[model samples]
Target: PKDQRKFGYAIVGLGNYALHQILPAFAECRYARLTALVSGDPAKARRIGAEYGIGPGHIYSYENFDSIARDPEVDAVYILLPTALHSAMTVRAFKAGKHVLCETPMATSVGDCQLMLAASKRARKYLMLGYRCHFDPLTLKAVAMLNGGAVGARQVVTTDNSDINVPLSEVAHSWRFDRSLSGGGSLINLGLYGVNGTRYLLDEDPVQVQACILPNKNPLFSSVEDTVAWTLLYKSGAVAHGSSSYTIKDASTFRVLGDKGGLLMDPATSYWANRVSLISGDATQSWGTPQFTLPALNQFSAELDYLAECVARQQPPVRASGQEGLQDMRLITAMYESAHTGQPVNT
Candidate 1:
């Protein structure tokens, strides 16, 4: 009651993501607090609940996730559920009168994405995607650099080379494998980064989506994709070419090419990009580079904190929103269709 504005959150699904990132990051967030938690497993919930000092009243189960709309302690819910479950829980969270910050892909389909957007509009709340890398320090500057003509009229973008080398013991239907659970395969799971990256890198919506997909021959990701290469054509006649391989050796970095110059990003800083290089002729220049910067932030924390502020201000986030997420899914949908049918996907 002391604060005039709302500033509390309840996380649904106390799984690895919630435990590893969300709750721990809450202590650093100045505007909001982790006021509640929800989980299906009683033992784990109780353990995590005790760890966070949340008592019975502040704790919830899957059966009662919707009831929290009535709980005064929670103004919003951070849904970290599997991709298939995001839409249902987000819809429920909306109906229960809570703002929802959902982890991405947003949903498996454009229809569900639009449904969530509609719910947010109807409930008069914000729906932000967990597109954490967009809020990265170096990424923020890189976006500006592209827009400011550091790389004049960006021609292409590349967001790729994720090393997805999981053991069979680590593999589980875990939602990542089931097309029903995860929407699609690696194309949707990992390729959204490239779709969204093109827009972010050049500040443009893709006019066309041309792509090809290959299976994970190693049995590690057969149900999903092992490799994807895409070309995003912009309205400005510029093209963004990207490739994503889940079996590389930590080869994740984005490069921007323009008429004037090109920029190469350090692979280490996708979430909190610190090292960036600008190349025009031969010599290179560095900007806003971090030299032994203090413990870097969890991008999700920065993302959630920004969202908490947006919720308070009745505004949208600076990065990916429900619409943006929907667009990415649309592109992904087109990619899968094209890959199966052996055609160029036009979005």
Candidate 2:
């Protein structure tokens, strides 16, 4: 049955996330299999490919990545490069006649995102964003509840996501601390969880964005902001507030308030382990992790399997499409513009 599947993926980038999370997830995926690997480092790619049971011919370096187009084994390319490389690599993958599943934020700029979308259209290939949280069990339950009117008419949303930044000296080897590579700091890295979460939970996009950047005076953050906060005003008169910081310990949470009821989720956007509760009138209901057909800890696998199904059925992915990622990038750009001008930016 596994051999009957239609999609085979080549993972690009051997970073920590790709090495630890995405690669291992392939073992749990039903429709998606790891067929190839593309990395800047040939040794790492070959080594990892061997471990994953891929042949030497399936391993590619950055310089020869386009050769994958002729490799029948690879039907899709999953990009896990830095923010700066996302756009270029996605376009290249599409040009190589492979469907693409790129990590979130799509690209560093709105223009880059547009180029990626255009490339996908030209190549007639599917392009999906790797927003694994969209496949998380708790997030699914929350979205279903909100859509079913369990929270009544939504009014306000508040989300916060933060984690301490690695020391500058230690981060020098990676592009994460570089302005050109990372695009922005805490907001793009962590606050994006809040941005995307609010949109999904409310099922609406913000019409206006206002923001403030709290730049860390520390020399370590001279290239980017250490903390940032922003507010989103939706067309329906609903509002959402989000904040992110690299100076704080782990704290990821969100709360949704409505006219008839509300929902609160602590550790809302975590990879695992989140607590959610519903509030209505004078009663508080606790809803633990919702049951999923897939393994509780395999969100990455779920995401990959979903994309494989989309490719097999020729159906577009609803939640993690390239358009969805572009929407977030557009809003992120607006948030930065608003922060710089000290005024609200209309989306």
Candidate 3:
């Protein structure tokens, strides 16, 4: 018999992103629904569960997370924990026979990414990365244009993503500023967007990476880099430059240059607003907001629906798989190594 029910998701971690963005997105998802929540704080879990109409029995704590395996309502686990905890939590979800959708920067290190992948494979379950941009309307248009020869062969790419940091004391317990918890600072948090964007735009991985971390005297960033810049060199002689900073005001944009034309995206990765332009010779064309088949489109909901469809059809995720995430982690690790050694590292 064909099961026509929506896939159930247990969202682990009641952090800001999960609470604000991911939780609300469940209302818009057609193929997936939030049936459970895992949090370290029982009070917070109970409050959110009440708001979402989730039963108390489906609420789980960090210590009792494994018990989710016995809950028939949870068919998948969305790992939204801190970066360092991603690997262990993902592995545990896989072992529980639940598909995983982990947030980006997958894990703190390449080794942890490998472990997560291995665990997913061992459990014979799908592991998807939560890369919302891959499902964004403007982003999808850019990808299609690049692949359709709108830009010909991409020659160079540049991106900037930055945001002002919160007070050290405020985030001290959140693990964002901890070196061990976050792996790196601006590079891992903000620059990973550029790294992944470059790869998707070029449709190829870089052959070499050169990076440098700008010195910061701020006490708040003693454990992580306050600002960082990196370059990626591709085999086709294409190059990409990316920068991320904690002290800068909010700015997110990327540009791609090719033989025939160029592409520009201002506020490229924002949740709501993004604009793209195509430049060829003296003429410039603007591609306004993209049209979607659905009545309402939320990036998070789309990604969740995509994962659910993949699970329902017994297919693997192509763009946002664990392997794709591992590739970015490897590149990030190499970039950090190159920055530390003051030398270019081969990918």
lDDT of 3 by residue, 103-186 (tens): 988999989999999998999999999999998888888888899998788999999999844655576565888888888899
- Give the poorly placed runs of model 3, Cα more than 4 Å off: 1-3, 164-169, 283-296
Give each model a TM-score.
Answer: 0.91, 0.94, 0.94
Give the local distance difference test score of model 3. Answer: 0.88
Off by over 4 Å in 1: 1-6, 165-169, 272-274, 283-295
* Candidate 1, 1-347: lDDT as tens digits: 44654478898998777888788888777677888898998888888889988888888999977789789888889999889899989999999998889998899888999899999989988888888877776677777777889978787776675654454457663667766787766567766776777777888888777778765567756667767887778788888876776555566667787887788775633544346677774445544343333345668778778888897777876566888888888888887887788777677
Per-residue lDDT of candidate 2, residues 106-147 (tens digit): 888999999999999999999999999988988888889899
Number of the top candidate by lDDT? Answer: 3
lDDT of 2: 0.87
| Model 3 clash tally, residue pairs | 0
Count of backbone collisions within predicted model 1: 1
Model 2 pairs in collision: none
